[model samples]
Target: MNLSMPIDAVTMLLMTQAIALVAALVLAAEWRLAKVRSLAWWSAGFATIVVGSGMSVLRTADSFLLYVWLANGLLVVAHLLFAKGAAAFAGRRLPGIWLGVLLVWVALLGTDPASDRTALFGLVNSALVAILSLKAASLLLSLRRTSEVRDAVRLGHIFLGHGIFYLAKSGLIFMPGLFVSLVGFKGLLIKASLYEGILVEVSLALLMLAAVRHRRERQITALAERDSLTGAYNRRAFEAKAAAGMALARRAGQPVALLLCDVDHFKAVNDGFGHATGDRLLSALAGILTDCVPADALVARLGGDEFAVLLFGLPPENLPALGRRICHRFAQSGAGVAGASLQVSTSIGAAASITGTEELPHLFDRADRALYDAKRKGRDRMSVESGVDLSVATPPLRLAKVARRA
Candidate 1:
């Protein structure tokens, strides 16, 4: 078999093969460690592209139907899979209608007039590719906004560029006389397409790998910084975040409030019931803190039934109210738990920075003293400390309505 082919055809063949190889390598990486589902779909898409391009290169003049069905069908399926992969990456499910569209396209290819009109086939293929590419790009761009990984944004831009390129290629086909002239020239249009395709393939492959890496790194970081039980930040993370928040507050001339809360009778709950029940109480309390605090506030578990909250831009007067809200919410939540006999209560100590010059440790110490005072004078109450600035007023410590034990 003579392997010699037109330069443009050879280039397309090589580009498709290269893309397939890259996708395979990415899939292999996914299998070994990452196990990303989207990579597998992308690999399948690249494989189909390789098969389609190969068929286009090898098809003879007599095999018109075979060429139309295999070449065009594979390319369309490849784009569909690419779209599916993008949806998977964005954690979205593609609609069933997309699969139906592909089925209809294959059915049209089998029809009498549709398969015979090569120019019409080209136009439809271009339109399908443009649509799928644009859809994939939109999904990626939307994901970029909420994603912490920077590579996701880069991948979005790449997908957007690829979509725009295909849209331009499709639009050129509708131009008067230009499509015919381009089709008449054997190598020109194909060469341009192959060049752009190769660039897009290389860029997308690299960016996809980077995106996966960034996401994995973020997951690892979260595991390290967060408490495994409650999904709250651990002690170390809490201190680091508190320091950063205090620094920001100082610069903005805003007050930062710290609340140190300890479960009132955690040991009693464990002794009366079991550790599991105590764990449930702590988890419930964490949920209450999350719900009661503002979105900008940082809530963390500082180990062993103690939780911390850092609130920025809140005045000293508001600390008492926030603390009460947390206690009230936790008490309300405790009433609804399965073990009604096990009463859960919290003692919270709040300290607010008036001068914006106080360090996190000193502020924490003040809150800890206040928390001790709350614990000493019965549980289920909040103690507010008016630090350094004597001008700042402190609200009276009041106990909220306690949840009844069965």
Candidate 2:
């Protein structure tokens, strides 16, 4: 298939410049501050220029004419790598064997001349493009299934744009010079490249926008789950975590404990020293709570001057010691009014999973009752409720009935 039509140097340069401009525009649109960045966006931008430049060079009768082929070959490799990056960023893993296959193809490209390997390499590359295109499509579908509309749109565009580009490129390689005589050499090939490059550029731009938007959404969600004053997980996050922990404990047939700790005289602290000092105290308490609990434990600010912890896989016998340790740590931290050495104390109520019927809210209620018992008995003491009163109650109903004899 000979492309006999006259394609002047000016026309070819115009086409290449157009492709470069499109790629640059999209690249700028997708620019972001991500940890690993979006590989698809970067690769698409790189391929646009690399392939366009290669095509441009191949047009000129210069010493670098052969180098242009090598450049395009490298661009193809970059395209594959970009696909892999896209899958990873989207939280999907591609098979390692695919990379091995691509490497073999690259080796074949190096050993085989363009005339000998063009058709075979094009076919192999097309197969690779098909795989990536399918993966992108599947990702988009999964996003839709999960109701990730923005992500779905972004990935769908990527799939559509790249699909078109690859199809056109594949056709161009497989049927080189087929339509060149009718329309011209630069006319057919350049048109195909330009169209494909434009689609790729637009898709990447939209995807980057989606990523930035998604990141912002996640940040907002995190903020929603955080306490405004102490920067700890709010009651909502705590409840959710508690429920999950209880479910896990049930599945594992293990014991789980819930702790409710309230700062003693917290209201007085706020009233006497103002909320500004109160807030600092709360922040300090938050830190102390975090330090006292296991790293994997879920700790949260349940409400005004109160915090909770859902300890999974904890033995019931350890509750008393753990509570004492927390109290000790809080005292050592000196979390109090006006930066002076202040003694801060908490009344802790602990409850353990007993019957399979125990739910998170029930556990919390038991803990809260125990906390009430602790305050009634006296502040600065730990109360454990396992259907028995750990501490004695006098005239004014100071003792809470534990679930069982502890």
Candidate 3:
């Protein structure tokens, strides 16, 4: 828990600069692998800060001392890059007003004719850095709110703390003694800011790495959970979602429904129009199923020419209407795809657990039976099965059938 390392006062700034360089390198390497533009912006920002700090260190050399304001300007630019990185991460445009911030700094520099303009602009520089850091924090927090990227929340907090620190540092200029004690070295050429800077750099580097890792993990999970051809939930994901959805609905005392949908004469379509056309049609069917169902519903492709929909919190009475819409929309979509010469449509079998007591497997079995019933009655239609009556010890295996034309 002792985060501190052995430090030499004279070399503290150099240590901070070294840490920033390493963070920049590591982030740049991650950018190469992940190809996230935000990482590139963050890395460049870190590198720019290091360059500015390095330039300030050169102030001991009499010739370089006069341009310390230049170093300060670069520090401000580094904060700008940090803000831009956050904007890119959140998919937002750069806040153009911040350019006015840099212009303000430039104007302050020209107003002062001192040999060391850094001393003159010290308060201004701190204020600008604080403003930029706060902007970055706000943008990062928005990323968390909008994208559900949990790591962005942590990064936002870190930047928020950094911004507040700089704001306090700017105010400390009024009390030179206290300012020196806080950010200045103990009678050494380096600064106390160096100590804090090293810690900040380390934190930023680790958290940004975690952010990119989190993104890559989500991408991998999506690939595994989705069907590549139809972009719907795969069989594995569908099974998982069905079990969980039923459990949640049962506990909430809400009804759940299952709709088993199969393409009518799918084999014939494949034979007549070729497999490529059939694949396109299957993809189109997935879209139709998604459009017809509620946003919370799960649409999955169980296998070739067959798909399933899991609905929760829906009344049993509405299931038939949804099935009819899906069937009808798919038939229309199919006709447009390969022309009206080929008759194409879908058959759906729907079953509902009105009492929220039936298990997923039982519901699936009932739905499968209704689906076949639809095919038997006629293709391009929807068939509804009787709802489960949990109060009955022996519920009827099969009951009423309502067939709706597509």
Q: List the residue pairs that clash in candidate 2.
A: 386-403, 386-404, 387-402, 387-403, 387-404, 388-402
lDDT string for model 1 (296-337, tens) is: 889999989999988888788776667767766676555466
RMSD of each: 5.0, 11.4, 7.1
Off by more than 4 A, model 2? 1-27, 30-59, 62-214, 335-337, 387-406
Residue runs of model 3 more than 4 Å from their true location after superposition = 1-9, 61-67, 93-109, 175-195, 335-343, 387-406
**Which clashing pairs does model 3 show?**
none
Give the Cα-based TM-score of candidate 1 against the true structure: 0.87
Better of 2 and 3 by TM-score: 3
Assess candidate 2 and give its lDDT: 0.62
Over 1-406, each residue of candidate 2 has an lDDT whose tens digit, in order, gives 2334444544544555565555545545555334444544444545555554545445432422243344445445555555565565566766776566556555664553434444454555555665566565565556556535476456666765676666666666646553232112344554454445445655554565566568667878889999987878998888787677778778878788888887777766666556786688778878877887787788899788888888877788877777777766665444344544345566788888853338887887899988888887766667877534443221221111122222
Could you tell me which 10 consecutive residues in candidate 1 have the lowest summed lDDT?
388-397
* Candidate 3 to truth, TM: 0.82
Lowest summed lDDT across 10 adjacent residues in model 3 is found at 390-399
Candidate order by TM-score, decreasing, is 1, 3, 2
